[model samples]
Target: MTGTDQQPVSASLRIDGKDAELEQRLDDELTAFNAAATGAGAPEPLSVRVTDAEGALVGGLTAWVWGSCCAVDMLWVRADQRHAGWGGKLLRAAEEEGARRGCTEVIVSSFTFQAPDFYRGQGYRETGRTEGIPGGHEDVHFHKVLAG
Candidate 1:
């Protein structure tokens, strides 16, 4: 037996106030951890949005860059705004902006029902895939070489 008995959390849960504090602590610790490996700090997070003539947001891409890689966290478009080429335009704009920020590659993920093929058409190559998600869809990872 161990020195003490411990109780597990109720469910897929976290200790109440431990969440943000723990995350922040890990982030702080990772600075030295990452710097030792990469010799650079994390990339600054960036967001790019597309709006209409009336200034309503229709689509956007959010990404971050570090070590010459732009990791896209989100790419979304309003339903009514889809297929008018806005998605592609927004993605390209994000890539161009990343290039300006010195990114040499782009990485993103998509569900099987999402934009995996669309990203492929945009020159991203599939790098990984996993199945058995909650929605029975596959998660696909892609990477692209950005033009200098």
Candidate 2:
């Protein structure tokens, strides 16, 4: 055979037809896994009470205590008394209660629509975040150290 008698080296590309189908299957599996994981757990219930200087209801905070940490589940101030330091006062009170209960840390979660900056101002640091809730608002998580 002559030196030039050889097969042509043609460049070709082969695309996998199952690429899109595999991606869809993986997405479906992930979605099912996430849904199952979320549905397997329930939040702990908490009770809270608040009173004004005159012993009337003004604001309150609620939390679930587990070991050395407490999860602040809710906090509310009277509408008419907002932006007047009542929220901070209530938070401080909650901190005191947590400390009394042997809690070394207090954690809180709120959406972008809530008082993230307020918590930051009160010495809480953002520890985590999530999306896709409350019309895509970010769920901001915060933590604070309690006095022993």
Candidate 3:
């Protein structure tokens, strides 16, 4: 709609929650735009999973490689499998895959009560932290350069 000044008016916004179709549409459009703008093409999903002998899920990592960077979206291990070094193994696998995809670095984050120390132990350095999260915890960010 055109406003009184004869300019296009912005569409009305809503707060409806959790729309998967809309989410996918937004992701698709943004990916197309990013590829067109940056010439980096599309992001490649990189997942590293660990399982038991029976193929039961134990731990995994989900990340994406875009341009020269790999962004770790989530890394989780089963409660029964925690501290067994599966997390590190999953991360290393992801990093190796990211490197194979032409990424030179990886970025990840965790909550204060989560695996900040784990990432540190994996040679990730804290880039920043956002305080005032619920329960007085902070969301910590980390980065690591992949070895050649």
Best by TM-score: 3
C-alpha lDDT of all candidate models, in order: 0.88, 0.80, 0.94
Give candidate 2's whole-model lDDT. Answer: 0.80
TM-score of 2: 0.63
Q: What is the lDDT of residue 50 in candidate 3?
A: 92
User: Can you write out model 1's per-residue Cα lDDT over 24-142, one digit (the tens) per residue?
Assistant: 88987986698789986766788889998999999998988887889999999999989889889988988998899888999999999988989999999999999987778999999
- Counting clashing residue pairs in each candidate, in order, gives 0, 0, 0
lDDT of 2 by residue, 31-125 (tens): 57755776522233354666767998888887866556778888988888889887888788777776776679989998989899999999999
lDDT-best of 1 and 3: 3
Supply the TM-score for candidate 3: 0.90
**TM-scores of the models, in the order given:** 0.83, 0.63, 0.90
Pairs clashing in candidate 3?
none
Q: lDDT at 27 for candidate 3?
A: 96
Model 1: ten consecutive residues of lowest lDDT:
9-18
Please, what are the lDDT tens digits per residue for candidate 3 over residues 71-140?
A: 9999999999999989999999999889988999999999999989999999999999999999999999
